[model samples]
Target: MRVRNKPWADDLITENPQAIVLNPEHYRGQWQSRFKSVQPLHVEIGTGKGQFLIGMAVAHPEFNFVGIELQKSVLAAALKQSLPAELPNLQWVLADGQGVNDFFEPREVTQLYLNFSDPWPKTRHEKRRLTYKSFLKSYAEVLGDGGQLQFKTDNRHLFEYSIMSMTSFGLNLTELSLDLHADVAASQGELENIETEYEQKFAAKGQPIYRLVAQFPKK
Candidate 1:
Protein backbone atom coordinates (compact mmCIF):
# COMPACT_ATOMS: atom_id res chain seq x y z
CA MET A 1 0.00 0.00 0.00
CA ARG A 2 1.48 3.31 -1.08
CA VAL A 3 0.86 5.83 1.69
CA ARG A 4 1.21 9.31 0.32
CA ASN A 5 2.14 12.03 2.76
CA LYS A 6 -0.99 13.40 4.41
CA PRO A 7 -0.16 16.38 6.57
CA TRP A 8 -3.72 16.71 7.87
CA ALA A 9 -3.45 13.23 9.32
CA ASP A 10 -1.19 14.39 12.07
CA ASP A 11 -3.30 17.45 12.61
CA LEU A 12 -6.40 15.33 13.04
CA ILE A 13 -4.60 13.01 15.43
CA THR A 14 -3.68 15.89 17.72
CA GLU A 15 -7.10 17.47 17.44
CA ASN A 16 -8.98 14.37 18.52
CA PRO A 17 -7.78 14.56 22.10
CA GLN A 18 -10.75 12.61 23.48
CA ALA A 19 -10.23 9.65 21.13
CA ILE A 20 -6.45 9.62 21.02
CA VAL A 21 -3.69 9.74 23.54
CA LEU A 22 -1.52 12.50 22.16
CA ASN A 23 0.94 11.86 24.98
CA PRO A 24 0.87 8.10 25.37
CA GLU A 25 4.23 7.88 27.12
CA HIS A 26 2.94 10.03 29.95
CA TYR A 27 0.31 7.37 30.70
CA ARG A 28 2.82 4.61 31.26
CA GLY A 29 1.42 2.24 33.91
CA GLN A 30 -1.65 4.47 34.10
CA TRP A 31 -3.78 3.15 31.22
CA GLN A 32 -6.52 1.76 33.45
CA SER A 33 -6.70 5.00 35.35
CA ARG A 34 -7.14 6.90 32.10
CA PHE A 35 -10.14 4.76 31.23
CA LYS A 36 -11.71 5.46 34.64
CA SER A 37 -12.80 1.86 34.89
CA VAL A 38 -11.25 -1.41 36.05
CA GLN A 39 -11.93 -3.23 32.77
CA PRO A 40 -9.06 -5.22 31.39
CA LEU A 41 -6.88 -3.39 28.88
CA HIS A 42 -6.52 -4.96 25.44
CA VAL A 43 -4.14 -3.61 22.82
CA GLU A 44 -3.95 -4.21 19.09
CA ILE A 45 -0.57 -3.51 17.58
CA GLY A 46 -0.38 -2.53 13.90
CA THR A 47 -4.02 -1.56 13.88
CA GLY A 48 -4.35 -0.59 10.24
CA LYS A 49 -7.27 1.72 9.45
CA GLY A 50 -8.78 0.85 12.90
CA GLN A 51 -11.42 -1.54 11.54
CA PHE A 52 -10.59 -4.53 13.72
CA LEU A 53 -9.94 -2.48 16.81
CA ILE A 54 -13.07 -0.42 16.34
CA GLY A 55 -15.18 -3.50 15.76
CA MET A 56 -13.80 -5.17 18.83
CA ALA A 57 -14.43 -2.08 20.91
CA VAL A 58 -17.99 -1.91 19.73
CA ALA A 59 -18.52 -5.59 20.42
CA HIS A 60 -16.82 -5.69 23.79
CA PRO A 61 -17.66 -2.47 25.55
CA GLU A 62 -16.65 -3.99 28.86
CA PHE A 63 -13.03 -4.13 27.73
CA ASN A 64 -10.89 -1.07 27.09
CA PHE A 65 -8.97 -1.00 23.80
CA VAL A 66 -5.77 0.79 22.84
CA GLY A 67 -4.66 0.59 19.21
CA ILE A 68 -1.09 1.35 18.19
CA GLU A 69 -0.09 2.25 14.65
CA LEU A 70 3.41 3.22 13.61
CA GLN A 71 2.68 5.22 10.46
CA LYS A 72 1.02 8.58 10.88
CA SER A 73 -0.28 8.53 7.32
CA VAL A 74 -1.74 5.06 7.73
CA LEU A 75 -2.76 5.80 11.27
CA ALA A 76 -4.50 8.87 9.92
CA ALA A 77 -7.08 6.64 8.32
CA ALA A 78 -7.54 4.76 11.57
CA LEU A 79 -7.90 8.00 13.44
CA LYS A 80 -10.56 9.18 11.02
CA GLN A 81 -12.55 6.00 11.40
CA SER A 82 -12.35 6.09 15.18
CA LEU A 83 -12.96 9.72 16.19
CA PRO A 84 -16.50 9.78 14.90
CA ALA A 85 -17.51 6.75 16.95
CA GLU A 86 -16.83 8.49 20.24
CA LEU A 87 -16.19 5.23 21.99
CA PRO A 88 -15.09 5.99 25.52
CA ASN A 89 -13.46 2.61 25.96
CA LEU A 90 -11.20 3.00 22.93
CA GLN A 91 -8.21 5.17 22.07
CA TRP A 92 -5.35 5.29 19.55
CA VAL A 93 -1.61 5.61 20.04
CA LEU A 94 0.82 6.51 17.30
CA ALA A 95 4.10 4.70 17.88
CA ASP A 96 6.25 1.76 16.92
CA GLY A 97 5.36 -1.66 18.27
CA GLN A 98 8.94 -2.06 19.50
CA GLY A 99 8.41 0.75 21.98
CA VAL A 100 5.22 -0.73 23.49
CA ASN A 101 6.95 -1.28 26.82
CA ASP A 102 7.64 2.42 27.08
CA PHE A 103 3.95 3.37 27.17
CA PHE A 104 2.63 0.78 29.62
CA GLU A 105 3.82 -0.58 32.93
CA PRO A 106 4.09 -4.18 34.07
CA ARG A 107 0.70 -5.92 34.14
CA GLU A 108 -0.89 -2.91 32.53
CA VAL A 109 -2.34 -4.78 29.55
CA THR A 110 -4.45 -7.88 29.82
CA GLN A 111 -4.52 -8.90 26.15
CA LEU A 112 -2.63 -8.23 22.95
CA TYR A 113 -3.95 -8.67 19.45
CA LEU A 114 -1.89 -8.88 16.26
CA ASN A 115 -3.94 -9.08 13.11
CA PHE A 116 -2.44 -9.65 9.68
CA SER A 117 0.83 -7.94 10.61
CA ASP A 118 3.65 -7.61 8.10
CA PRO A 119 5.43 -10.87 7.49
CA TRP A 120 9.11 -10.01 7.68
CA PRO A 121 10.03 -12.99 5.52
CA LYS A 122 13.80 -12.64 5.48
CA THR A 123 15.54 -14.77 8.07
CA ARG A 124 17.85 -11.85 8.86
CA HIS A 125 14.75 -9.80 9.74
CA GLU A 126 13.40 -12.32 12.20
CA LYS A 127 13.65 -9.89 15.07
CA ARG A 128 11.35 -7.47 13.25
CA ARG A 129 8.47 -9.90 13.34
CA LEU A 130 5.91 -8.94 15.99
CA THR A 131 5.89 -12.52 17.25
CA TYR A 132 9.68 -12.62 17.51
CA LYS A 133 11.07 -13.54 20.91
CA SER A 134 12.55 -10.07 21.38
CA PHE A 135 9.17 -8.44 20.84
CA LEU A 136 7.35 -11.08 22.91
CA LYS A 137 9.68 -10.37 25.81
CA SER A 138 8.80 -6.68 25.54
CA TYR A 139 5.11 -7.54 25.53
CA ALA A 140 5.58 -9.68 28.64
CA GLU A 141 6.70 -6.60 30.54
CA VAL A 142 3.33 -4.89 29.97
CA LEU A 143 0.95 -7.86 29.97
CA GLY A 144 -0.94 -8.80 33.13
CA ASP A 145 -0.56 -12.18 34.80
CA GLY A 146 -1.79 -14.96 32.49
CA GLY A 147 -2.24 -12.36 29.79
CA GLN A 148 -3.01 -13.77 26.36
CA LEU A 149 -1.77 -12.85 22.90
CA GLN A 150 -4.07 -13.49 19.97
CA PHE A 151 -2.51 -13.59 16.52
CA LYS A 152 -4.01 -14.04 13.08
CA THR A 153 -2.21 -14.03 9.76
CA ASP A 154 -2.53 -15.27 6.22
CA ASN A 155 1.18 -15.93 5.85
CA ARG A 156 1.92 -19.56 6.63
CA HIS A 157 5.60 -19.01 7.20
CA LEU A 158 4.98 -16.20 9.66
CA PHE A 159 2.32 -18.20 11.43
CA GLU A 160 4.65 -21.17 11.84
CA TYR A 161 7.47 -18.90 12.98
CA SER A 162 5.14 -17.30 15.55
CA ILE A 163 4.17 -20.70 16.97
CA MET A 164 7.82 -21.62 17.44
CA SER A 165 8.66 -18.25 18.89
CA MET A 166 5.87 -18.42 21.46
CA THR A 167 6.94 -21.88 22.57
CA SER A 168 10.58 -20.81 22.75
CA PHE A 169 9.58 -17.89 24.98
CA GLY A 170 7.97 -20.36 27.42
CA LEU A 171 4.49 -19.02 26.55
CA ASN A 172 1.75 -21.60 26.48
CA LEU A 173 -0.25 -22.05 23.30
CA THR A 174 -3.94 -22.55 24.05
CA GLU A 175 -5.59 -22.51 20.61
CA LEU A 176 -4.38 -23.25 17.10
CA SER A 177 -6.14 -23.06 13.78
CA LEU A 178 -4.84 -23.15 10.22
CA ASP A 179 -8.09 -22.05 8.64
CA LEU A 180 -9.90 -19.57 10.82
CA HIS A 181 -12.84 -18.72 8.58
CA ALA A 182 -13.67 -22.35 7.84
CA ASP A 183 -15.82 -22.54 10.92
CA VAL A 184 -17.96 -19.55 10.00
CA ALA A 185 -20.94 -21.82 9.50
CA ALA A 186 -20.85 -22.90 13.13
CA SER A 187 -19.57 -19.67 14.56
CA GLN A 188 -20.58 -18.61 18.02
CA GLY A 189 -19.14 -15.11 17.59
CA GLU A 190 -15.57 -16.50 17.82
CA LEU A 191 -15.87 -17.77 14.26
CA GLU A 192 -17.87 -14.69 13.38
CA ASN A 193 -14.65 -12.75 13.44
CA ILE A 194 -14.22 -9.04 13.01
CA GLU A 195 -11.54 -9.08 10.33
CA THR A 196 -9.29 -6.23 9.35
CA GLU A 197 -9.31 -4.81 5.81
CA TYR A 198 -6.42 -7.04 4.79
CA GLU A 199 -8.09 -10.07 6.32
CA GLN A 200 -11.25 -9.59 4.27
CA LYS A 201 -9.24 -9.25 1.07
CA PHE A 202 -7.17 -12.35 1.82
CA ALA A 203 -10.21 -14.41 2.74
CA ALA A 204 -12.00 -13.26 -0.40
CA LYS A 205 -9.12 -14.70 -2.42
CA GLY A 206 -9.53 -18.04 -0.59
CA GLN A 207 -6.38 -17.65 1.41
CA PRO A 208 -6.35 -19.66 4.59
CA ILE A 209 -6.07 -17.60 7.76
CA TYR A 210 -3.98 -19.04 10.56
CA ARG A 211 -4.63 -18.16 14.20
CA LEU A 212 -3.03 -18.82 17.55
CA VAL A 213 -3.58 -17.87 21.18
CA ALA A 214 -0.64 -17.85 23.56
CA GLN A 215 -0.58 -16.93 27.24
CA PHE A 216 2.21 -15.45 29.30
CA PRO A 217 3.33 -17.13 32.50
CA LYS A 218 1.11 -16.51 35.52
CA LYS A 219 2.37 -14.04 38.07
Candidate 2:
Protein backbone atom coordinates (compact mmCIF):
# COMPACT_ATOMS: atom_id res chain seq x y z
CA MET A 1 0.00 0.00 0.00
CA ARG A 2 2.05 2.91 -1.27
CA VAL A 3 0.21 6.18 -0.76
CA ARG A 4 0.96 9.10 -3.05
CA ASN A 5 3.05 11.73 -1.31
CA LYS A 6 1.11 14.78 -0.17
CA PRO A 7 3.06 18.07 -0.03
CA TRP A 8 0.71 19.50 2.59
CA ALA A 9 1.27 16.55 4.93
CA ASP A 10 3.76 18.35 7.15
CA ASP A 11 1.58 21.43 7.38
CA LEU A 12 -1.47 19.39 8.44
CA ILE A 13 0.46 17.81 11.28
CA THR A 14 2.07 21.05 12.46
CA GLU A 15 -1.15 23.04 12.21
CA ASN A 16 -3.32 20.58 14.15
CA PRO A 17 -1.54 19.73 17.37
CA GLN A 18 -4.82 19.08 19.12
CA ALA A 19 -5.89 16.34 16.76
CA ILE A 20 -2.47 14.99 15.80
CA VAL A 21 -0.50 14.33 18.95
CA LEU A 22 3.21 14.89 18.17
CA ASN A 23 4.59 14.22 21.68
CA PRO A 24 2.76 11.06 22.71
CA GLU A 25 5.62 10.01 24.98
CA HIS A 26 4.84 12.89 27.32
CA TYR A 27 1.23 11.76 27.69
CA ARG A 28 2.15 8.14 28.58
CA GLY A 29 0.03 7.13 31.62
CA GLN A 30 -2.11 10.23 31.49
CA TRP A 31 -3.75 9.74 28.14
CA GLN A 32 -7.21 10.27 29.62
CA SER A 33 -6.29 13.88 30.26
CA ARG A 34 -6.14 14.53 26.52
CA PHE A 35 -9.79 13.69 25.99
CA LYS A 36 -12.89 15.66 27.01
CA SER A 37 -13.76 13.18 29.69
CA VAL A 38 -11.90 10.37 31.43
CA GLN A 39 -12.79 7.15 29.64
CA PRO A 40 -11.46 3.81 28.49
CA LEU A 41 -8.76 4.11 25.84
CA HIS A 42 -8.92 2.11 22.62
CA VAL A 43 -5.99 2.35 20.23
CA GLU A 44 -5.64 1.17 16.65
CA ILE A 45 -2.10 0.52 15.48
CA GLY A 46 -1.24 0.79 11.77
CA THR A 47 -4.30 2.97 11.21
CA GLY A 48 -4.06 3.96 7.54
CA LYS A 49 -6.71 6.32 6.17
CA GLY A 50 -8.61 6.19 9.53
CA GLN A 51 -11.94 4.92 8.23
CA PHE A 52 -12.40 2.16 10.82
CA LEU A 53 -11.34 4.25 13.80
CA ILE A 54 -13.42 7.23 12.75
CA GLY A 55 -16.48 5.02 12.54
CA MET A 56 -15.60 3.49 15.89
CA ALA A 57 -15.21 6.89 17.52
CA VAL A 58 -18.60 7.93 16.21
CA ALA A 59 -20.33 4.72 17.15
CA HIS A 60 -18.79 4.42 20.59
CA PRO A 61 -18.57 7.71 22.37
CA GLU A 62 -17.90 6.03 25.73
CA PHE A 63 -14.33 5.23 24.75
CA ASN A 64 -11.44 7.35 23.57
CA PHE A 65 -9.75 6.38 20.29
CA VAL A 66 -6.14 6.89 19.20
CA GLY A 67 -4.97 5.97 15.72
CA ILE A 68 -1.26 5.40 15.24
CA GLU A 69 0.21 5.60 11.75
CA LEU A 70 3.88 5.44 10.82
CA GLN A 71 3.80 7.31 7.52
CA LYS A 72 3.49 11.07 7.66
CA SER A 73 1.50 11.47 4.46
CA VAL A 74 -0.84 8.67 5.43
CA LEU A 75 -1.30 10.09 8.91
CA ALA A 76 -1.98 13.48 7.39
CA ALA A 77 -4.55 11.98 5.08
CA ALA A 78 -6.21 10.32 8.04
CA LEU A 79 -6.15 13.66 9.84
CA LYS A 80 -7.81 15.32 6.87
CA GLN A 81 -10.64 12.79 6.95
CA SER A 82 -11.03 12.87 10.74
CA LEU A 83 -10.74 16.63 11.35
CA PRO A 84 -14.13 17.57 9.96
CA ALA A 85 -15.82 15.05 12.22
CA GLU A 86 -14.50 16.94 15.24
CA LEU A 87 -14.62 13.84 17.36
CA PRO A 88 -13.79 14.76 20.90
CA ASN A 89 -12.78 11.23 21.76
CA LEU A 90 -10.51 10.71 18.77
CA GLN A 91 -6.80 11.59 18.36
CA TRP A 92 -3.92 10.58 16.08
CA VAL A 93 -0.31 9.59 16.62
CA LEU A 94 2.51 9.76 14.08
CA ALA A 95 4.97 7.09 15.16
CA ASP A 96 6.16 3.51 14.79
CA GLY A 97 3.97 0.78 16.25
CA GLN A 98 7.00 -0.86 17.88
CA GLY A 99 7.15 1.96 20.41
CA VAL A 100 3.58 1.47 21.64
CA ASN A 101 4.63 0.57 25.14
CA ASP A 102 6.80 3.67 25.37
CA PHE A 103 3.76 5.85 24.67
CA PHE A 104 1.41 4.18 27.14
CA GLU A 105 1.87 3.08 30.71
CA PRO A 106 1.44 -0.51 31.84
CA ARG A 107 -2.24 -1.47 31.72
CA GLU A 108 -3.11 1.96 30.39
CA VAL A 109 -4.89 0.82 27.25
CA THR A 110 -8.33 -0.76 27.47
CA GLN A 111 -8.31 -2.35 24.04
CA LEU A 112 -6.09 -2.66 20.94
CA TYR A 113 -6.97 -3.04 17.27
CA LEU A 114 -4.74 -4.41 14.50
CA ASN A 115 -6.41 -4.07 11.10
CA PHE A 116 -4.77 -5.16 7.85
CA SER A 117 -1.24 -4.75 9.16
CA ASP A 118 1.65 -5.65 6.88
CA PRO A 119 2.27 -9.38 7.07
CA TRP A 120 6.06 -9.18 6.57
CA PRO A 121 5.56 -12.74 5.34
CA LYS A 122 9.22 -13.69 5.06
CA THR A 123 10.44 -16.08 7.77
CA ARG A 124 13.28 -13.72 8.65
CA HIS A 125 10.81 -10.89 9.24
CA GLU A 126 8.64 -12.80 11.72
CA LYS A 127 9.83 -10.55 14.51
CA ARG A 128 8.36 -7.58 12.71
CA ARG A 129 4.84 -9.02 12.77
CA LEU A 130 2.41 -7.32 15.13
CA THR A 131 1.52 -10.68 16.68
CA TYR A 132 5.18 -11.55 17.24
CA LYS A 133 6.06 -12.43 20.83
CA SER A 134 7.82 -9.14 21.58
CA PHE A 135 4.98 -7.06 20.18
CA LEU A 136 2.44 -9.22 21.99
CA LYS A 137 4.40 -8.75 25.19
CA SER A 138 4.22 -5.00 24.81
CA TYR A 139 0.52 -5.19 23.99
CA ALA A 140 -0.10 -7.32 27.04
CA GLU A 141 1.71 -4.83 29.22
CA VAL A 142 -0.35 -1.96 27.90
CA LEU A 143 -3.67 -3.80 27.88
CA GLY A 144 -3.07 -5.67 31.17
CA ASP A 145 -5.01 -8.74 32.21
CA GLY A 146 -8.17 -9.61 30.31
CA GLY A 147 -7.96 -6.63 27.98
CA GLN A 148 -9.23 -7.24 24.46
CA LEU A 149 -7.18 -7.46 21.23
CA GLN A 150 -9.19 -7.35 18.03
CA PHE A 151 -7.43 -8.16 14.74
CA LYS A 152 -8.56 -8.27 11.11
CA THR A 153 -6.73 -9.23 7.92
CA ASP A 154 -7.32 -10.45 4.39
CA ASN A 155 -4.12 -12.56 4.33
CA ARG A 156 -4.78 -16.13 5.38
CA HIS A 157 -1.16 -16.83 6.27
CA LEU A 158 -0.99 -13.80 8.53
CA PHE A 159 -4.30 -14.74 10.14
CA GLU A 160 -3.11 -18.29 10.84
CA TYR A 161 0.21 -17.01 12.14
CA SER A 162 -1.54 -14.51 14.39
CA ILE A 163 -3.75 -17.19 15.94
CA MET A 164 -0.71 -19.23 16.87
CA SER A 165 1.29 -16.25 18.06
CA MET A 166 -1.50 -14.85 20.21
CA THR A 167 -2.42 -18.19 21.79
CA SER A 168 1.24 -19.00 22.46
CA PHE A 169 1.52 -15.64 24.21
CA GLY A 170 -1.20 -16.79 26.67
CA LEU A 171 -3.93 -14.64 25.16
CA ASN A 172 -7.32 -16.31 25.13
CA LEU A 173 -9.04 -16.52 21.77
CA THR A 174 -12.54 -15.28 22.49
CA GLU A 175 -13.86 -15.19 18.93
CA LEU A 176 -12.79 -16.17 15.42
CA SER A 177 -14.38 -15.52 12.05
CA LEU A 178 -13.02 -16.79 8.74
CA ASP A 179 -15.41 -14.84 6.53
CA LEU A 180 -16.74 -11.91 8.47
CA HIS A 181 -18.77 -10.33 5.70
CA ALA A 182 -20.47 -13.60 4.88
CA ASP A 183 -21.29 -14.19 8.51
CA VAL A 184 -22.59 -10.69 8.90
CA ALA A 185 -24.64 -10.95 5.73
CA ALA A 186 -26.23 -14.21 6.82
CA SER A 187 -26.84 -12.84 10.29
CA GLN A 188 -25.09 -15.81 11.78
CA GLY A 189 -24.32 -13.97 14.99
CA GLU A 190 -24.34 -10.61 16.68
CA LEU A 191 -21.27 -8.99 15.19
CA GLU A 192 -21.19 -5.28 14.60
CA ASN A 193 -18.06 -4.79 12.55
CA ILE A 194 -16.43 -1.56 11.48
CA GLU A 195 -14.72 -1.79 8.09
CA THR A 196 -11.34 -0.24 7.43
CA GLU A 197 -10.43 1.39 4.12
CA TYR A 198 -8.40 -1.66 3.08
CA GLU A 199 -11.20 -3.96 4.16
CA GLN A 200 -13.74 -2.31 1.88
CA LYS A 201 -11.41 -2.64 -1.14
CA PHE A 202 -10.30 -6.20 -0.40
CA ALA A 203 -13.82 -7.35 0.43
CA ALA A 204 -15.11 -5.84 -2.81
CA LYS A 205 -12.88 -8.34 -4.64
CA GLY A 206 -14.80 -11.11 -2.79
CA GLN A 207 -11.94 -12.06 -0.49
CA PRO A 208 -12.73 -13.47 2.91
CA ILE A 209 -11.91 -11.27 5.87
CA TYR A 210 -10.37 -13.04 8.87
CA ARG A 211 -11.09 -11.61 12.28
CA LEU A 212 -10.17 -12.64 15.79
CA VAL A 213 -10.89 -11.22 19.21
CA ALA A 214 -8.50 -12.29 21.94
CA GLN A 215 -7.89 -11.26 25.51
CA PHE A 216 -4.80 -11.20 27.67
CA PRO A 217 -4.75 -13.90 30.35
CA LYS A 218 -5.41 -12.79 33.86
CA LYS A 219 -2.44 -12.70 36.24
Most accurate candidate by lDDT: 2
Against the true structure, what is each candidate's TM-score? 0.94, 0.97
lDDT of 2 by residue, 46-114 (tens): 999899999999999999999999999999999999999999999999999889999999999999999
lDDT of each: 0.87, 0.94
Deviation in Å, model 1, residue 211 alpha carbon: 0.8
Evaluate residue 38 in candidate 1 and report its C-alpha lDDT on the 0 to 100 scale: 71
lDDT of 1 by residue, 1-219 (tens): 677888788788777777777678999978876675679899999998899999999999999999998888888898898777778888888888778999999888999999998898999988789998889988899995699999999999999999999999899998898888886545766565788899899999999988898999885
Kindly report which residue stretches of model 2 are placed more than 4 angstroms away from their true locations once superposed: none
- Residue 13, candidate 1: Cα error in Å is 1.7
Clash totals for all models, in order? 0, 0
> What C-alpha RMSD separates each model from the true structure?
1.6, 1.1
